[model samples]
Target: MTSQIAAGLLICLCATAWRMMRSLPAWLRLATGAVLLAGLTAAVVQMVGSPLQPVFVATGAAAVVWEQVVVAAWWLLAARLLVEVLRSTLFNRGLAAKGRLQGDLLAGLIYLAAVLTVVDTVLDLPIRALLATSGVIAIVLGLALQSTLADVFSGIAVGIERPFNIGDRVWLEGPIEGVVDQVNWRSVRIRTDGGDIATVPHSVAAKSRVINRSVPTPQRSDSVRIPCAASVPPERVAELVRHALLLSPRILAQPQPAVALVRIGRRSNEYEIGFAVASSNDLWHAKSTLLEQVLRQFRSAGVETADRPGGGATSEPDPASGSRRFLAIPLFHDIADDQRERLCRQALSRSLEPGDALFRQGDTEGSLFFVASGVMEVTRTVGARSSSLGRIGAGDYIGEIGLLTGAPHAATITALTPSDVLELRKEHLAPLLAETPHLMHAFEASARRGQALFDRRVAASVGAETVPPGQLLARIRDYFRVHHVRPGPDAHAARRHPAAQANSPPGGD
Candidate 1:
């Protein structure tokens, strides 16, 4: 009779467990159902109603022990299933929700509660007593680990407040600047422009004053200070600086650019050229192109910059005290003064009349041209269609990509107006490359930058009318006016003008 009752109880348990399994999630159902089946099998084996001798009862008792083991296994499996379900649900909801920081914290708390619930229910423990004890322990731990606790709480606060998000350029209290990589429970990870990763404790990050460059709008006004020789009129310097920034592709157009004479020093006058940029990531590149343009413009205009006492002579002057110091483009500023001088020397001046073709698309690459006086249009012909790539103006370089790759010119270069250009041949670059492998990296980097700009312009023009060859010339002219600069004269005239020659150092004497 007892054996029959045991078998009936096993059947009932198996049915109930199967129902539970069907009601559960797919992953949980498989794990929990397997455990329940093992338990039912053990219970059935232990049934004493089977017609057997005393030895059979002893064997049945051993099977009862196995049933207990199965029950314990079922509890473990149930706990595991609960944890996984809670984790998955919390993670999915947290990530999908809009306020990332708030969602993450809430999700973590939910996970913690779910874990505790699983422990209490599956293990059949008295949770209230454990909770009371944990509260007391937590208070003691909080006092002892003040800083760590602060960090954890601060991390939570960061999620809730969200001063910055991933990919934001932030300046923290320590004056450290970087793009926020992630926000975690204890710390925030930032990857600096130098490619170094910094882990800042959430406590510090939360309390510290942070400048979120990516917030509200990613655009920010940036300034570069260049010292001009006192000989150059301050008004002309300002105009020149403003014009240089306008020609740069990196400068934002909506805000417009401004230049001011910040201070006058013994050897030079310091000027600040201010402009807005679309992003902090573009800051370095924009500044580099700006400086290059400024130097080229100043040189073409017969303006002399302050020189370093030894051989590292620069074209800009030092500003007086109390003047706002401008930021220099980091990488380009690292080039030795001698290399820049060699580059200037190796460059050959040329002038192109309007309608002149500098090179066709299939022409062999020879030298890269840097615009020194006027505007040129770059066009690519693919199949029967011809598309305008972009316009090159004073200080912009062309043909570097093909020169480096030893490929035919990808685009046809034509003079949009009477233009001036400084040509740097591959042979002249060999000595520079041999002396500094770093220059090669710079050239390659510049080429990649040019390609990126080309890609962006091409993408923006997609679906628009294919800009006619004449329309391209008109567009180039419009771009110049919008930037507040006009092409002055042909390259040959600019080079031979009395003003340019007057600024030349006395060599015949």
Candidate 2:
């Protein structure tokens, strides 16, 4: 009896030590536990077979109580070892949130089986009667804890299905939208964008609609409804909204944002600007930025909003008002009003539908194009891989370098919408350059700025000295067939270029 008690104490001590050395490698800990359990079993076998067995009580059943205690302890140690092995081998490392719950449930079953075995095998009880009695008790407990059991089963189902994992951004039917923080047997914890933690139960989550935004890709599609005066053309409003979407860095360009008139009212039209962001979290910032950009674009183009206090929409700019268009251009801002009108008269208006190429890369046409209204994309192709350099919208100009330096178009310009472009050929500009001799310096400065920007955009290396101002001025004069080009007093000031300055608010870098 004393030997049996010693064996039980040895088993308990081994279990405590195994649990204490948790930082050890799992396999090594498991091996140590198996060795201890085997040693205890051997010690008990030897004690029961040897003549030196000790008796604690006179009654036969009580005399074997110590053996039963040792047997039960052995069974428990074996169950614990099996549980540890299963936990290390079959659960959690890849299972993520579902692993621990599954491990616990498995361990419970193993321990229950060990306890039943101890009752029937060690103490020699009637297994059939015991199971029959346990069946009724199980039914009673299951009914009493119906909701809890439902949660448990639902958690298992969730684990098996894996609709969303930890760290995924999800939307539940409870209107609960957030990043999954922690998932357990009872509930899933979500960290919301508003910095609040939401606990949603597995049963509720299973029954509700679950949206996993993190799967496949984190990109999220969103849109905003913009109210514009119905007086403005739908095509015009769509172009402006599309330009604003292209301007936003947070908004993705691959999907190509869309703008469409969804609703028309008595005095206003509602346009839906649909776009995508890199992640669900970026949706708000992208939307707000796009809205700001849209407002700026509308203001710049004199397009009125439906909510404008007077309820009267501003009329669109006259396409034939060349001088007014020239005044809006920063390039012609230095030209006097009368000279600008003459310059505008010499320019030719060219209209384009969407997908029309104004000029392609490597085209050496010595002409400048000014966007009267609409958006154009600038793309540069290098070794079969074409990348977008930027987008140009209303009031932006292109082909300055091609015109001034007689260089081929460094990038292709394609009309993104129904666009009105004004073309000024070198031949038409020479007489004006000869009359307004100082315009050569403005053109030189603008060309230099354009060349620098083009070089930066294409990632071309700039020499320590590119074209000198004298050489660039000579090239412009030679290209335009103009003689005796005079430098203005502000020519040196023009040399200190705002290289980073954007041509238009919607123009891309």
Candidate 3:
């Protein structure tokens, strides 16, 4: 009866081990392997008294060996289960999750300890006694694994210091620069930009200098130096540099750029333009772009570019009127020339690449945008899907509704081609509106049209009811602080009519 029960249990253990192969944990796999070996030995033991053979191993000691292996396998399975429980209840928590290598190492140690405990308790093995007797051999083995021990300790130090995470962009001394792929007990694997995986020992990683680009912040400070002729006013030179920087949409609006004359030489003045870009991913590219822009602007203004510290003097008047860009758009037609020039100076010019997002839906900034060139696609996200609103082209504007009404963007706007846009932010509008009280009315009709478009899109997107214009105008007046301006019919729909084609907003031209 004992032999039959042991045979059944052994068969069950083998089946269980086969089922556990899907698990990724090395310790669990090891324990499963041990179970398989024990089950094979137990099957032979069960056949000892059967017709297969009087004793499968032809010796009683062989049977005892099989039983001892069973004890060890059982202990290993118990340890593996305990490790799983600990992993779920504790080791998988936030901080511990960051130290996965350490967790695996600790689990491996627990598995070895379980084997030792089983040897001493069930098999009556004297583990400590053997170690004491073979102290010299133990010392020799430790010396043999010195490098391995060093790696384990070094890995622990790296984990604690955590200079970089698994996905962080890092560069080490020598040719080890890439994204960290994995951190293990003995080494780290880096996936280089070339798609090759490089495994480096933790000891080497701990000893070398590791620069983590993603840490602290990804923004980078850059400086561009250019030589300008003494003819152009320093203020005009600064303005030109600023305009060039603004043209690149990747540059952030905050931490405003600074341009200064660093050195005044006899022939030319050396100006240094210092600015921060959005990221450090392409430091060289950003520097190259700024240099190109500075040179182009200098040439267009006929400001001689000097090779060295000195500059040559040349004079060329700016042909384009300051208000030319604004006057092209019909919305600002009523503003006085001086006030229009102020708006133009306050506006920032941006060149956007095809597929770049001008603004996302639900953004609350009140900034008007004019499409100087190229086309724009407007979309509204409804639930899990998106619906197209319409397209805006040269001289057509969007975001004025949000800019004037202080409401969330009704739709997302994206560039359909390499496009140029003039952005009029709140800072540019508040002073103009506060000073010229009547100027507020210029936006009233435009605001109503924008709201109508938003309402129409909302209705078309989800079949929702249209909002009453009176209510929308009320909200608009409160947002723009234009209670004095009487509510009027929206000009957008009327302008779209055949009879009013002359008053229609400019399309792509």
lDDT of each: 0.59, 0.72, 0.64
The alpha-carbon lDDT assigned to residue 387 of candidate 2 equals: 86
Q: lDDT of candidate 3 vs native?
A: 0.64
Cα misplacement distance, residue 375 of candidate 3 (Å): 18
Per-candidate clashes come to 8, 1, 4
Give the candidates in order of lDDT, highest first. 2, 3, 1
What is the TM-score of each predicted model, taking all chains together? Answer: 0.52, 0.63, 0.52
Measured on C-alpha atoms, candidate 1 has an lDDT of: 0.59
Model 1 misplaced stretches (Cα beyond 4 Å): 1-90, 96-130, 217-220, 264-267, 306-372, 381-509
At residue 423, what lDDT does model 2 achieve?
90
What tens-digit string does per-residue lDDT give for candidate 1 at 146-216? Answer: 99888888887777677777778899988789988877667888898899999999888887999999778
How far residue 221's Cα lies from its native spot in candidate 2, in Å, is 4.9
lDDT of 3 at 153: 84
C-alpha lDDT (0 to 100) for residue 255 of candidate 1: 92
- RMSD for all candidates, in order, please: 15.2, 8.3, 14.1
